[model samples]
Target: MARHVLLAGIIGSTAYGLAGPGSDVDRIGVFAVDTVELHGLRAPRESYVTTRPDVTLHEAAKWCRLALGANPTATELAWLPPDLYETRTALGDDLVALRRAFLCAPRVRAAYLGYAARQLRTVERRLTGPGGANPRVAKAARHLARLVAQGRQLYRTGTVEIRLADPEPVRRFGERVAGGDLAAAYRLLAEAGDDLDRGRSPLPDRPDDEAVERWLRAVRAAHLAVA
Candidate 1:
């Protein structure tokens, strides 16, 4: 059976407005199949892919689960600019409408900061390893800085800014990290974490799970009826 592609949009560096001349265009999407297919002898795959520019499409249920957990990659897909979309059906519009339903201050803090911390550790390891300085460390540092900045904005505004609206400061911090200034990188991460720990965020502690569930059920029902 043909997969129903509910949403498809640009992601990665291009989606973030950080793409350079050599940057590859990356895309992600969500697709849904009839519920019966999921309950049959062979379960539908959780993901699909296409090559060239590179697109990774997750099953709708799987995407919803990841978004609920504030998986940065998956959640960000819902916030992409309208012009960036290559495909968006009514179901996709509904999915995007519920983007805020997946956001909670605490989850954003954990997801963004935790991912940045992992990047920092990777950079630290690379710095101490025989490879010395490499482009990967600099890239990781840039992403780490971006994550902290994005996390802060989300906590304060309840919305994520995928592209760095102001990239200068992050650019400078990335330079420090690239120069082997691990101290500065750690400081940035700590400061971001501390700010979030203050618990001053105006966002709710948990997402609107009921609303999301209702939407999911409606979508599944519509798909099943047509199938």
Candidate 2:
């Protein structure tokens, strides 16, 4: 069956306004499977990832699951700026409009900080491992900072800010951490923890699962109609 992409958008360093020379242009998207395929004896693939163009397209149901869990990378699709979007169907627009339904305090805090922990490990490895100054480490450090800032924004304002207002500071921080200053990375992470602990956020304690279910039903219905 032909895959139908409902939404696709530029993400990663480019979306955050932190891309440099030779940076990979990453794109992520959501696609719908025919409703009938879901009942097949063999389950259809839920995700398609290609490195040639650095794109990942998730099945609609899978995308909803990840977003509902506050997966930082997955949630980016729902909050991308208009220009960053490469494709947006009517359903895609609806999904974007309902992004707030997927956010919750506990999941946001856990997912962001949990992803940051992985980046922290990368920073630590760069500090002690050979080739400490490799560009990937710098990228990881930058992502570490980005995740914390984005997470904070979502929790504090109930809105996601994809592009950083001041990206130079994040770049500088990455450089510092990649240059063997693990303490700098730790300090920033600690501050993020503090904010999550003390911040009075506008987000709810639980996500609006009913709204997500309604949207997913719409997606399935749309696919079935076309089929």
Candidate 3:
């Protein structure tokens, strides 16, 4: 229950303002120890709060043949700022190997770009262009497109840097909605926009189409490499 609540909080708080012309990916994880292994001297490998940076949880996931290579969050956490987490156990070694396993050559770049393009096309035809009423949908679309750029950066550099910080971005997105800055508010009085459209998104008056396309290419290339 706690884990679910935490995940929801992260998503709900950041999902709105975190976008651009596309949506954003919200990644998270949870780990727990086993009860059967906790017999007398043998304790299940327990996760605990670590003395890290802005991150709050850091635990070494024990690497078993069945468990090691499939854990994406475990592998990703290893690359966070040193202050955020630390892992020197045998399991950590397996995770390092898994990173190499998930990466492909340059082909992943095309896949990510294709994925973002599909999304943009879908939104243009269905949501943002004609009769769509989702106030923040355009911003969400922008975020998704830019993420393609962030992903490409990851692939070329072999590093993942989180752009959407918590709380602030989300709140700003909501504030735009509260201010009635959506397409639906176009005809309302400037002062009346806030009262009439209480749940709108506040994207820029206009997002540059070229910027969205370019960002998608850069981000897509990088996302594939973040094992």
Report the number of clashing residue pairs per model: 0, 0, 27
What value does the lDDT take at residue 86 in candidate 2?
Answer: 96
Residue range with the least summed lDDT across 10 consecutive positions in model 1: 166-175
Q: Assess every candidate by TM-score.
A: 0.93, 0.96, 0.36
Model 2 Cα lDDT, one tens digit per residue, 1-227: 22899999999999999999888999999999988888879998899999978999999999999999999999999998899999999999999999999999899999999899889988888767875577777889999999999988888888888989999999998888877788888888899999889988888999999999999999888877435
Q: What pairs collide in candidate 1?
A: none
lDDT per residue (tens digit) for residues 112-183 in model 3? 444445544544444545565354454444443344533454445545444344435434543443343443
Q: How good is model 1 by TM-score?
A: 0.93
**Pick by TM-score: 1 or 2, better one:** 2
Error of 3 at 79 (Å): 5.0
For model 1, state the Cα shift of residue 48 in Å: 2.1
Lowest lDDT 10-mer window, candidate 2? 126-135
Ranking by TM-score: 2, 1, 3
State which candidate has the highest lDDT.
2
